[model samples]
Target: MTASDDPVLTEVTGRTGRLTLNRPRALNALTHPMVRRIAETLDAWEHDPAVRTVVLTGAGARGLCAGGDIRAVHDDIRAGGGAASAAFWRDEYRLNARIARYPKPYVAFMDGIVMGGGVGVSAHGTVRIVTERTRLAMPETGIGFVPDVGGTHLLALAPGELGTYLALTGQPVGAGDALRCGLADHFVPAGRLPDLLTALAGRDVHDVLADFVGEAPPGRLDAHRAWIDHAFAADTVEEIVDRLLGSGRPAAQEAAAALLAASPTSLKVTLAALRGAPGLGPLEAVLEQEYRVSCAALSAPDLAEGIRAQVIDKDRTPRWSPASLAEVTDDDVARFFAPPAGRPLRLATGAAPQEVPW
Candidate 1:
């Protein structure tokens, strides 16, 4: 798709419908409009017999998607809370659920910086492709936000304590670690993505798999695995942070520093959400918890401050409310899981997991 028309492009290639994120300059950070268009196109193609499969990727080599348009979401929160912005999240989460349960073979080339909202679009696909350039994360805590777009669900599904570690610390995992954690299916080199996509356009999943000709890069996270597994094994975010701080390992120390820099309240609530999420009744239940948390995040002092410092001001120093994790009470975290006055998440029923397209 050309940049002139839409940031997201939809094209039919044989029986495959390709959705390309087309904002290279911004690393294809998803705007609300982009999400809407993608959802609309997917809805159209879902039941269209003409389209047998769907492939989602980005336009440039730099990244697949950096995440949501946090600036827009931040602006909405600043304006005021009402139906308009609330509806955007509702629709976005619904799209996420639909993608998770999409009937056709859905393939996501999770090339780079597939964090936050980007994870929503690509992680739930039948096939998740990782490349050497892929830098996958769920870094909402850093910005006073809980991981949304059904990220909690995926995090819950990740191996061992890695999900909690990621939620609390916002650490980036490379392709090998992503594969180890079940976030990605196959590792392919960046240079070969086009030819693979070209081959995938006219063929079946089996054919596409057969055509793949790339080797996995050397794993980067192996040395830190022991620390990651142990430190994040703590029951709470505070405990995890404390353990990391005391570990004395350089990586652990750096990670602790990063966590300390994030909004304390964000860390508290995100940890609670990730731990509680796995037992939630369904994806919608988890999303409802996330929605409540997200709305509450707007009201909290840190969100706007984080956005101002990080995006608007570009100052890189947010003065977070409840400046330390110890100051954030459990009650504060609990409020986010509670439902709003009347509206609740309207989730779809009858979702069943399908075979992962190899």
Candidate 2:
């Protein structure tokens, strides 16, 4: 797509390569074209001596990004079957890996509702900045999906069972909680974002960031860390639910309610994915596994059901196939990890010789 038509706005300002998620109307929800554009721009900027750093942000005030265009994915699933949806995940995950491994100073101005695909793009960068308005989450499970975009890798690295708690509950967190969870590196006020970008033109990015960094307000996650660990420490989801129910604490009760409301298959697969993530060799491995789950999920109908209930019909009630946690067996979860019948995601291990196609 041309610059005017593109959802992502890319430009070079002095020594910095800047990208703005331009789809403000859609809350900067990423499409395949947008993802490819970002990957290509980053690739081009990586080798350019003139570009010392990269700055990413979203347009308008809603926040950096909401996530991928799930409505579009829903349409793709309905019309073109799984091919289009699979292709999007494959490309999107590849871009996520690229961001995580980018060598230069990559700064993300995560000031709004950063979730799912937003987290995929920004959280993996070298310097992740969250503002007071920042609300972040890896909330794919709510949509009958496991958190992809190397989310499992980041979740695995979170303190103790917090990753399990966040992944299963799909809870949105603020700047302080984001920092406490290792989701963000610094907290900058939303009003100062323009100054941060302006400073990036001539000054060192670190100096600019340090100058603009503000103390984040207190977060509740640390206070409940013990409860979170105790409730989510179980080897299985059922056990975790049992623990939560037995805890009698308000936080445990809330978490249990959230988990119970999520898709059964998504909960099972997400639990297994996060549990097995630490042992996975690399980010690419996690992406590969997630790709398998996403592709397999296309056939399960929960994805479509989720979109219908949550986004399309606005019913707020999803009729999951397994229906209950007991119905989601080991075999059901295992199938999600199996290799796709078509092609597996082949992530770039090093610098690429050719531009990644859309």
Candidate 3:
């Protein structure tokens, strides 16, 4: 119940520690500083003998986190400085890896708009709590970026070709869909979250979740699973778009519209990454592919134009470099996944590589 003075409030009650992301004005959109703070606090709590568990949540009613502060990333690009942005990504990725394999019990209250970076922070937790208000996504493609923060790993694990669909289109999944898709572990009422946290602080993590049994609200994604799988299974984004347009299914058509409106380069790279990311289980491999694609994306014309149209100009009219997916060459997509000249993608394991299921 104790609160710190930081933008991200860190508090401890008995053996439990809580970290609250506080930036409701922008839906708690994360900045580089916030990422550093969260990582620092987590590192601190990891070694603290008194803290048996850690809980992460956001302040206010709107949501947990919308995503990263793209406006800042855009500005960094505009300044013609790559090191700063690259460094931010390096640190953020490290934090994400730490969270994914944290030693202690880590719980995430994934309420509201948990997208992109929010997903990175919360989805990897031992206990992921979703509510009716939860609307989760890995929507980096919509903003002219590939999903980072170990997003590729989760995308690789999504059912069937649904990962490609969601990654390419940046679709939002509600609470039930999130649970069914393995993004969340438990579903509790939005109003009951505070009480649940209190209960968790007073008891063991598993027991706390076990005691709060409530009927999960119905999900929206399951009904459209077949459509999502079929439409997104196309080999190319253009083909996928065409199928979606031709399917006559309302959901697929809507998804197509969203994809068409997004940055063409982002859509292309995202689809390619999800397709090629399978069988890569280590978090470092996933992050490396994403980092390669991201660094290449910064130099592409579509990224700047996308940010200009969406965030800067607020015009919602972007002129993509290739203009259409058909124009995007296989070489262009390949360049993103290809290792750089000297800096190859490396995994961060100590004495021995961690054994993963797949």
User: Best candidate, lDDT-wise?
Assistant: 2
Better of 1 and 2 by TM-score: 2
- Per residue, candidate 2 scores C-alpha lDDT tens digits across 161-231 of 88889999999999999998898999988989898898998877877777899999888798888889988
> Which candidate leads in TM-score?
2
Query: Where is model 2 more than 4 Å wrong at Cα?
Result: 1-5, 351-358
Residue pairs clashing, model 1? none
Candidate scoring better on lDDT of 1 and 3: 1
lDDT of 1: 0.81
**lDDT for residue 174 in candidate 2, whole number 0-100:** 93
Worst 10 residues of 3 by lDDT: 349-358
Q: Model 1 over residues 169-211: C-alpha lDDT tens digits?
A: 7888889888877788888788788887778767886667856
State the weakest 10-residue window (summed lDDT) of model 1.
Answer: 349-358
CA RMSD, predictions in order = 4.0, 2.2, 3.4
